[model samples]
Target: MKLPYALAKRFVAGESLDQAVPKVADLNEHGIKVTLDLLGENVKDRKTADDTLQHYIELLEGIHAQNIDSSISIKLTMLGLDIDRDYCRNNLFELLDAAVKFNQFIRIDMEGTDYTQATIDLYKEAFKKYGKHVGIVIQAYLHRTKNDIADLAELGADVRLCKGAYNEPERLALQNMDAIREAYKEYLKVLLDKTVYPRIATHDNKLISWVKEYTQEKGIGKSRFEFQMLYGMRLNTCKALAAEGYNVRVYVPYGTMWFPYFTRRLKERKENIWFVLSTMFQK
Candidate 1:
């Protein structure tokens, strides 16, 4: 069944880049930075991958031309990572090249456990070639995150740490909420100590408070790191952080392929599911 456009719009910006930029501008007007993500993933064909690449390039061009204070995030599978490593790398290089040309940034988003290692390898290769304009995300729920963070830290790579959203087997991912939260804290400490600018992305108030206290104790000013939240999840919290003078970036996802992303988000938060059901039955 197709999801109602109104229901999905709570999370997705719209079906096209043109519809999305005004949203980015609105967030920027509220003193929040933006990270635009095209909502397709796991492309199985080269044509789709190539099209995704061009869309990203055009998105970057629009961002630069409009003078929007925003960056972009992309999934490797959308760029043909599953098709061929070399092909995927070349596609990424094109996007990174465009980002460099525009003096902007691109973040390689991490997917499931299966793609973790390959994604990291691609990110390292891209970062080595593209330099400061490229970055990657790390999921704290993964048992290997500490070591991965250490490796990225040694390279002085840009990192965004999130308490992952995917469901995984017990063998590969932490199943306990407390365990994931603790891992998030430890991973963040390592990131703050070694990485130049780590993005802390979470909605937990305890974690948010802890990050503030921890950074203050370590004498890390607000500028050394940033706080990130999804586009529609916690607008007030994001606004509050921005008001407190911390760099806050809103992760805004948009595209016609939004069902998978929307369903995953609904599973992550029961309240969101309830909101949809409630809205569906509204007068």
Candidate 2:
């Protein structure tokens, strides 16, 4: 593996849980919460998926034992969604049992368009049983996300809304920036109006400012929802929001199978490329 150790250090906590603890603690010290995502997905076999399930249970135990103020994010494929839906769901339920035990929360991370509906289906199934401790993410670029958000709103689901990271086709996703942002505006209203403590995930300054203004105009308290950003992208903004008494959470990802997540990070933002190059030269 051609590990871009520099970028990995920037975006991922580490390749192991032992290396992630301090990172999480530092964010907590700064008054920001965390949602730890163990970076692995699209598992093709049962043993690996089963191992993933077990590792998550261990992760929960470890976080609880360390007294970490962090929740976790899960990708269903990591738990075998691509292999079998029922098997994946069973794994999710088992992990939710651990979440219940520790009184921690788990947010299901949304993948590409192909996995969207099945992800939601499994999430709803999990929510029906362990709704209090489970949540899901939705992408703003997709045309179907409007309906997805409506369903989540009705369910009063705790959702994380992002502008999407997948390279979706034009027919299925909003290709123009203006169209995507407009869709985000409508989605935000529904999320704030009906969802339970939605997390708005974006690094766009205008969108961030707009969310502050929109929520304020609607009389929504700062504690009503959260502003979520990737772990290494916006520490200053996260701290500023925290200082302002707004709920802010950082999505901290770490694991040995981190290459996929790492590449996704670089592709998600042009700034990430510059971030890597700038930091590389600095070193």
Per-residue lDDT tens digits for candidate 2, residues 5-88, read 666778989888999999999999999999999999899999999999999999999999999899999999999999998889
Tell me how far the alpha carbon of residue 200 in candidate 1 is from the true structure, in angstroms, after superposition. 0.4
The C-alpha TM-scores of every prediction are 0.97, 0.97
The global Cα lDDT (0 to 1) of model 1 is 0.92
lDDT of each: 0.92, 0.90
Candidate 1's displacement at residue 211, Å, is 0.4
**Candidate 1 TM-score over all chains jointly:** 0.97
Candidate 1 structure quality by residue, lDDT tens digits, 1-283: 8867778888899988889889999999989999999998899999999999999999998888888888999999999988999999999999998988999899999999889999999999988898899999999999899899989989999999999989898888899989999999998999899888999999999999999999999899999999999977899999899999999999999999999999889999999988777767776
Name the lDDT of candidate 2. Answer: 0.90
Question: Among all windows of ten consecutive residues in candidate 2, which has the lowest summed lDDT?
Answer: 1-10
- Residue pairs clashing in model 1 are none
Best-matching candidate per lDDT? 1
